[model samples]
Target: MTAKYLVTGASGKLGQSVLRHLTETYQVAPGDIIAGSRKPETLSEWVAKGIQTRVVDFDDAASMEKAFAEAGRVLIISTDALDRPGHRLIQHKAAIAAAEKAGVQHLLYTSMPEPANSPLLFAPDHEGTEAAIKASTIPAWTILRNNWYFENVFLSASSALASGHWYSAAAGGGIAHILRDDIGRAVAAALVAPTEGKTVYTLTGTKAYSHADIAALIGAAAGKKISVVEVPLEGLVQGMVGAGLPEPLARVFASVDTMIGVGGLAKVTADYKTLTGLEPQGFEAWVDSQAAAFNALVK
Candidate 1:
């Protein structure tokens, strides 16, 4: 009997993509995979395809244990419970405990690059989760340290297009932002083919792009010339807040520049190709593909 694979948070963007790649890209048997989501009903399509859909509430230990009990491999997608300090870590620890109690053979987790040394405010959550996973009794595990997503720039792209200015606090540092779907494809490959004990892969794009470089790419794609205006970190936060973002959320978003300015997310790696045997999407091409969307933002 082949081991069953369980993917937590299967209803999310990354999770859903992973499921698609597992069945489509890797041709994994749907019956051998379990899709775990807080609301499993959202995955009715998968359930109808002979896949097992189970509830995987991070806050509920008993349910999580039940979700993992039948799976030999488990992928724990990091939760987005950053609204409260320490809350995310608590949830991750519970998942680790549940996986151990359920006798899972291999555990995999989605983490950020260099979490322990990162300047991002949420780095601690990933760092703590990685530490907990390392301490768990699971026989084998894989840690994927994914870089920033290219889509993340869209958060400020609309406002930048509206004002014709891309403000930044990155201090000329660059970020190799990989596509979320590419990461999902790589993750699906990793989950299906278990690596040796305690392996880590840093999935990143081929090149790093500074704020100016990114602005140029977006400007060219949108047919609007956008200029980069370097500002202090505080100024960036204030601008975001002035743009109607909540102050707390603005600070959190602005921290990405803080992290970038320090070269925290500037590294490029080939690990993504190693996992999926294909190149991650390039920024220029990705921007070009989203050209219509960018044009709509300016209009």
Candidate 2:
């Protein structure tokens, strides 16, 4: 192999997981990999392992171009720029420009679920980025439209589980949630594989279920009674605001809940399974595996 792999945002949780998987599971040589981050110093461990870490900021074109100079493939890990409007899309566009300049052969981007169809508050940025990638001159690209993560459950589960109460905007819709690692693995698969003809995929869990089902799983695993409560979309946003999220972030969660309620997050597919040749984990299985982590975080 002529050493082809450039992972942007490698310091991020998902990026780190993908890097670990590539090294451990795939046995990819560290020297063949390149990681990009604003603070490459943070990746001292990976660097010690022989992976090259470079300071590449999406906002800084020169750094990005230098980072991808010799990279044959690029993974534009979506920026967590939700806190600022249009910031993520602009950053993505910049990365695409760099990838093009670097003569990168492929691009694997992380995208949200059905951004084109969902009005889930912060979907416009993803939609806009998708459009830009489509319009770009890049030879090949893969859009991994990942669904909601099972981790979101823990954020709302512990509090309500102890109180025997739960709340959500998704009234009856079922969510096909996957772990963050799964998303990372999917991204890696897209990045390294010869997926020239494949441009898009909806990655999700093996199964999908509504909140009531989620409560049931959590309750069964924890040996406690947990109730699932539905809230009006507007009330859901209000509840989020009361929880200390900024008005915009609160509304974003509310709309996500609304999307859940309307099956926005239920678009499960066999793409992940097909890509990785392994069945995706189920919602309950994820919760069970996180028992220790959840217990430590509880109380």
Local distance difference test, each candidate: 0.91, 0.83
For model 1, name the residue pairs that clash: none
**Best-fitting candidate, measured by TM-score?**
1
lDDT, candidate 1, 65-183, per-residue tens:
99899899999999988667789999999999999999999999999988997778889999999999998899999999989888888987988888899899999999999999999
For each candidate in turn, the TM-score is 0.97, 0.94
RMSD of 1: 1.4
* lDDT accuracy of residue 275 in candidate 1: 88
Most lDDT-accurate candidate: 1
Question: What are the per-residue Cα lDDT tens digits for candidate 2 across 1-299?
Answer: 24589898999999898998888867788999998899999999998999998888989999988888868888888898888877888998898888888887788888888898676877888898889888888888888898888888887786776677778778788889998888888777777786675478999998888888988877777767777787788887787788777988887777877788777888779999878888877777778887676555434
Clashing pairs in 2: 170-261
Worst 10 residues of 2 by lDDT: 290-299
lDDT over C-alpha atoms for residue 44 of model 2: 95
